[model samples]
Target: MLAELIRRDVDDIVDEWEQFARSSIPAAEDLSPEDLRDHARLLLLAVAADLETVQGEAEQHEKSRGELPDNSPQITATAHEHAQHRFEQRFTLDQMLSEVRALRASVLRRWVEQNDRYDPDAVAELIRYGEAMDQALTESVAFFGAKVDQSRGLLLGVLGHDIRTPLGAVRMSAQLLERTKGLDERQSKAVQRILSSSDSMRSMVDELLDFTQTSLGMRLPISRVPSDLGSVCAEVLAELEALHPERDISLACEGDLSGQWDAGRVGQMLSNLVSNAIQHGNELPVTVTARAGAGDVSIAVHNKGRPVRPQSLATLFEPLAQAKDMGGDRHSGSSGLGLGLYIARQIAVAHGGSLEVVSSEQDGTTFTARLRR
Candidate 1:
């Protein structure tokens, strides 16, 4: 009965809904009347048609849970298209939801006005109508959120990539300055500072690129080739030593550390692990060890310092966990996006490996990464 009522007064209902949308949303000021009315009418017709379909108790439950397949393709398509249009017009999520609320209210008010009093059948039809409208709303919200995420991911990816070119030039120039003849101690120190800052910027930009790629449903890219884990670990340790001349760190390797893996990515993972250790290890010695198993190799970086909080252990490898978990003194002198450990774990997973950590007062903290050959 409600479905027939909607069909009979669809035009009037759509006109009122469009007017409400135009008034509530500033973005709608630029939209033509026809554009605002088109999807609302189609969505209303789809909901009315769906209300006429017979459904059992089980189906009703599934519909209420939104587990049922959208039986009306038009409802889904129209909602998706409407959401896209709103997103392109720079409409906020709240504004889009307000339009749905306005449409539902207009239809319900018309139906109630036509019916003199409440009846059992009318109440049941109203519930079914609400479920239909809810489904449409869910679809629209999902589409709009996805579009926002995709756009943000793309913007970060492009910005990060474009920044690398200029950043690389600055780093190279600083390196050249460090080698320039007849430079005083202060001048040399300034150049070294520039080089160090550039390295930090490069690391941040790399993390941003990697984070965007993974957030946008893309896997961390890796190129597997014949490599030596021992060599990679030694190279990473050497670089860390150059960067932190004040710190004491050492590396040890046992068994054959040869494997089929992405050498550069593995080096990056080790670098992140060791850097994390040096930063939080309270000026104590940091140890790096590598050992080969039957078909895999494990690399561990151990640090002697205050133990990581028990509650923070679970999220240690999560992006931005550093900012959330590490505060005050622990976060001092640390300038990163907190993506280092997260990206390290992703690299391990991409190489068909795993990464884990253990921390305690007596034993300190150790992060171990195992990679399959």
Candidate 2:
């Protein structure tokens, strides 16, 4: 049913395009080859727009349904059919039009190319018309694409907000349960586990909500005041130690490491990086280092682990990329929505800084966050 509605929408757009093309380019009996070619290019643009709208609508409908549509396989088949139709119908028209335009351009350019007896006024008029048509088509395509992106972002933001509300309430209730009295040791352990699980779910929900907001160009509200990078590192290290008392973690400071940044964001970034390193890195000691300079400050969290693969390196900052299998370790129990590095990078960018990764088999991996002066 939704597919039919989308298909109808595509048809409507196509009809609108046809009307636009007919009005823009009249079908005169004595039309020049260049005019015909321009009409054909406009037609092609309309067809491309129709295809994009159809595809986008189908994808969105699928998402809304929370499952693939019943007609999805049929739709895929129809898309192949449409591709073949393009070659048969639209491609031929485009090629014929292109050839006509090229021939006309070549004939007219001969006068200018030879610098001979031909008048220049007519050639200038042809060039001007061609440039105008090109600009109009380019602008139209860009405008439509931007509209589609904005629509998608708004939908995702709404969905993220709805999902987070319930998750937040569940987390609060779980914490309340943990504080109840008269529980035996075994029951206490179970309650603690529930609290931990709730915390993890809440974190995942927050990350998704943040990503949605960022997708819509929303910036994090971070206040920049004098903050100690060393202090931030120490706080994050302390939290991690409390969480994982079995792990040997150390914090090292090379200088006073004072800087200007949002204290909360800085702390969040460090906590994410350090937690990731400890979870994925080898059992050897993990180190958090801070260095201050005249114009900038740098913080790095290093861990001993297997080198990250080259292909996965580019996508490291993308959410959900490592939440499932960190370096192929299934036992890690890190089933997150994959927003840690993504959020860290966003915060760094917001602070006019950057985050980077360096890894080697022998030395392990180091993730650094640098804030400029």
Candidate 3:
């Protein structure tokens, strides 16, 4: 009966709902009256349809918890679609949820105010209407959360793709400066800095793309090429040394060190680990040990300093995970994005390998990566 009551006075309910949206949600500041009203109208209609259906007591109990699998999909589909559209409109989850509650409340208040004669069946009707409204809200929340994730993935994908063009141009300009005949030593060194910065930017952009792809439910793509593991680690270490000339970094290799892997990705992993060591353990020499086993290869970067906190260690390989003041400053002077270890671990996993860490006051921090050769 309330569902029918709602259908009869839907226009007045929508007006009241829009008034609440305008006053409550800051994201609605720039939206027109229609935009501010958002999905509440369709959702209210969906809720009305759901209430009109004849649900048995068993199904009613299921509906109360939003678990009416048989009927919910068809009943709540419009609400879910409205949720996705609202996400693109920049409505916060809480704001959207609030509007749903307002719509339900407005409908009930109207029904109670308009009718003087109250029937015993009105109570049952109210309960059913409430359950259906809640079910629709649940569906909307689910779709809203998914849309948030998708939007983030798309943003990262676009950002990483768009930033590379300027980076490549800067690198080329730096290279051209290096070839200038009248350049002094200072000018050449500055050019090298620009070139080095370009390399760092490119690496970051690549990591961002990888992060975005993975967040979008894709694996980190890698191309396997014939390569020497020793050569890969060696070049990575050389770059670190060139970047941090004052720091002492020692690399020790044992057994055969050649393998078939993505040389660039492996180098990226090594660079992330070694750079982490030097930045965290600058007071002491950073040690890198590489070994090629019968069927696998292992590389670990060791440094002595303060141990990583237990809480920080748990999420160390998590993307954007950073410890307070832990990422202090890098030798390259660029602030870390907190994705280095995360992307490194992803690369390792992509290559059928694993990356882990051990840290203590006594033994220090050691990041080890083991890969199938």
Candidate 4:
């Protein structure tokens, strides 16, 4: 009975929905009837299937909010396809919402007109219809938002990569200016400032690139070769100390430090963790320790400072989860985008390794990366 009703009313529901779609979404104005009605038939059929399903009130409550993740992939997949098409067709969230609202109202209007008078069970059917609609709408919204985020991430990745060529040229010109003849002391300081600012810009660009690549379902690229992990950490530390000589950073390497891993990526991760330590730690010396045992290598960056709150430990590795004011260490190269630890963790994941952290008042905080050698 439910399926028959949907089969009877699907065209009307779609026509009414398309009118709302066209008015609300400029892109939908150009969509053909096939495109505008994309998946509407399947969506209505899925709702009809749900109405026929024998589900308890408890299950209904859970499913209404799209909480029954294991119930029906067919239904969810249909909704996801609908959302993907809408996203590709450039329908905004608002327009999509409007279309769904119009669909429900149209279906209700048809149901009312069909019986000529309201059935006593109309309220019960209405509740089940709303639940099914909610599930489909939730699935659609989730898919739509994911597609939108991926597009944004891809755009940022391309933008960040393109910005680097010009930035490198600027850095090269700044270096040449530093070596210019007949430069006064004031002129030299100005050149130094320009160099510093350019380096900061370069770091920001690199972070943005890393963030976007990871967000867009791509890993940061790395080239693996025989490299000494100890030397890599030392080289990274030397560069960091030059930028932050006032702070104390020491490296301790033990056992075999040579490995077949991406030296540049390792250095990048080490640099990020150490920089994070310096920024969040107190005026104490930050320590980086690398050790190789058997077929495993571990690197730990340690600092004695305030402990990361327990609540924050869960989300600390998430991109941009840290506060801006908590960062901004002059040499940290973090414009408070909070991507350092996130990028570092991703580098470890790409290397088939893992990044872990332990923080406490007594022991301070430590970020450790374990890699298989």
Reference-based lDDT, each prediction = 0.87, 0.61, 0.82, 0.83
What does the lDDT read for residue 179 in candidate 1? 84
Residue 222, candidate 1: C-alpha displacement in angstroms: 1.6
For model 1, how does the per-residue alpha-carbon lDDT over 303-359 read when each residue is reduced to its tens digit? 987788888887888776663544324332244667889899999999889999998
- Alpha-carbon shift of residue 96 in model 2 (angstroms): 24
Model 2 agreement with the true structure over 188-219: per-residue lDDT tens digits: 88877877776666556566667777876888
Screening candidate 3 with a backbone cut-off below 3 angstroms (N, C-alpha, C), the clashing residue pairs are: none
Over 4 Å off, model 4:
1-3, 22-42, 45-78, 112-128, 323-332
A best-first ranking of the candidates according to their lDDT comes to 1, 4, 3, 2
The per-prediction CA RMSD against the true structure, in angstroms, equals 2.3, 15.7, 3.7, 3.2
Q: Please give the lDDT score at residue 282 for candidate 4.
A: 77
Best-performing candidate as measured by TM-score: 1
User: lDDT per residue, candidate 4, 98-207, as tens digits?
Assistant: 77777888887778777765565666777888877777788889999999999898898889889889988988998999888999999999989888988888888888
Clashing pairs in 1: none
What TM value does model 3 have? Answer: 0.82
Where does the lowest 10-residue lDDT sum fall in candidate 4? 323-332
